[model samples]
Target: MKLTLERSALLTGLSHVQSVVERRNTIPILSNVLMGADGGRLTLVATDLDIEVSESVDASVDAPGQVTAPAHTLYDIVRKLPDGAQVQLTINDDDRLDIDAGPAHFTLPLLPSGDFPKMTADGFTHDFTLPASELSRLIDKTRFAISTEETRYYLNGIYLHSKDGLLRAVATDGHRLALAEQTLPAGSDGMPGVIIPRKTIAELRKLIDGTNADVSVAVSESKIRFTTGTVVLTSKLIDGTFPDYERVIPRTNTKELVLDNKVFASAVDRVQTISAEKSRSVKLSLTDSNLALSVNNPESGQAREDLPVNYDDEALEIGFNAKYLLDVAGQIEGQDATFMLESASSPALVTDSDDDQALFVLMPLRV
Candidate 1:
């Protein structure tokens, strides 16, 4: 392959596909990016067996062919090259990729592109389009709670489903859960519930421009595809059933405490400094309209702070992971974050005072 690409254009394509390349790979081609140049365009593809990200950019195609090269190394070289420099890439006779830009030159070992695995995406049952910002809201609101434990593979991704004319996403990690809902457009009425893997959620989130562009989505039983402009993401769905997250959402919590979102988050952040490294526990003591936040660690020290809230309910005390509380508070869009508590042992439900589309549930920790 022989082609020349504007530095910005080449960098754009490489940036979109880098996350799909795993840093450690057992297979050779899986670690390299496949580059194809033809018809005045260059396409870059990176895959980690389960997920694949591809981007095509306009370029000067001297000769139409394909080659595979180290994704990160090539990206780093282009990143360091001077601005506006034209990048020339060619496949050498010795099966290496020659990169030349400005005064710097580097050769990366080339692997056969045919060996790169592609996810099978056939028989798409539902196809629809969502505004970029809306899709981003759905993913961002819930991704923080996605389980990182490999033993519970089913909980490692967000559950996406269409219900009651809304597209809902729910993610949970046993300790905390986040649920977000967005209006569903036409043709997405009968979409099946699918578990989008953690890596795909992250890659797709990166593609969202949060602008006027609309993202095209196609969902099949085994795979899901998201395309925005020249970038495409294909991922295999986790073949497992997501737990009934709705059951975990409490409906009978009557106690309410409303406080400034930023104040609560800041207080949590400050008090957690003295929390134990192992538990990271923070105690919440609610009395009348005053809320006290405190953390004690034998090895470290003790931290305490107080903030007046809108609560007038029965005085209650609860314990929670200081970091998890901050994460939930950070997602609140409005000025006030309201928490509905049932008791000291039960989970506390959190929601923005004005935003009804997002909700969070936090299980209390024993201090």
Candidate 2:
């Protein structure tokens, strides 16, 4: 293939594609990006078996053909070129892709384009469009709570589905759960709940970070695809069932405490300074109107901080992971963070004082 593309355009498209190609791969073709020049645009594609991304950039096409080259190496060459310089790419008969800018030159060995794997778009049953901002909010709010444990694969992704005109995203890692909801972007009445893998969530987030325009999504039985004008990403969904997360959320915890979120988070941060790295345990001593945050480490030291709150229930003391508590507190957007409790040993329901759309739950730790 032969084409001349703007340096910035090539860099942007390469950044999206090369990120999908892992730094190391067993299959040589999987380590390379497929580039095609046709219809006055250059198409770049990359994949790592389960997920694939493709992007097209406007170019001055002098010839029409396709070739594969090392994704990262090509990206690096273009990225280091002078700003606004046009980059010329050509595939010679010797199977080397030559890259040229104003005064710099580089060549990358090419693999046959036929060896590149392409994900099919068959069996797509659902298609929809959503605003970039709303979709990002849903991901950002729940992705933090996703599990990193490999054995429990179901918790490794954000669960997305639509019901009763509401689209919800939920994630949990056994220790804590996060749920966020928004109005359904389009028809998804019969769409099955999908457990999107952690890698796919991360890739989608990067794809949407550059544009504010509306994007389209298509879902098949075992795959999902997102597309903007120039970028397209297709990923395989996790082949597992997510647990009945609703059962994990406590619905009857009646003890309520509301405190300024900024104050609560800051106090917890101060108290956790003395916590041991392994346990990270913190105790919350609660009374009519005061909450005390404290941590003790036998090998080091102890810390305690008190904050005022609005609570008139029976006094209680609860033990929780300091990191978990702070994570939940950071998600609270209102002036006050609300906690609903059953006892010192039960899980705590966390949310904003008035908003009900997003919820967080934290499991208690034994002191």
For candidate 2, the per-residue lDDT at 234 reads 93
- Candidate 1 lDDT, tens digit per residue, 130-162? 889889988989999999999999999999999
Please give the lDDT score for candidate 2. 0.90
Q: Count steric clashes of candidate 2.
A: 0
Off by over 4 Å in 2: none
Model 2: what TM-score?
0.97
Q: What is the lDDT of candidate 1?
A: 0.91
- Per-model TM-score, in order, reads 0.96, 0.97
66: Cα error in model 2, Å:
0.3
Best candidate, TM-score:
2
Instruction: State in Å the error of residue 128, model 2.
Output: 1.2
What candidate 1 gets wrong by more than 4 Å, as runs, is 209-211
lDDT, candidate 2, 1-367, per-residue tens: 7889899999999999899889989999999999999999999999999999999999999999999999988888888899999899998778898898988988889889999998887788988888888788788879989999999998899999886789899999999999999888766656788999999999999999857888788887699989987899999998899999999899999999989998999998899888988879999999989998888888888889988899989999999998888888878878988899999889999988656789999999987
TM-score of candidate 1 to 2 decimals: 0.96
Per-model C-alpha RMSD: 1.4, 1.2
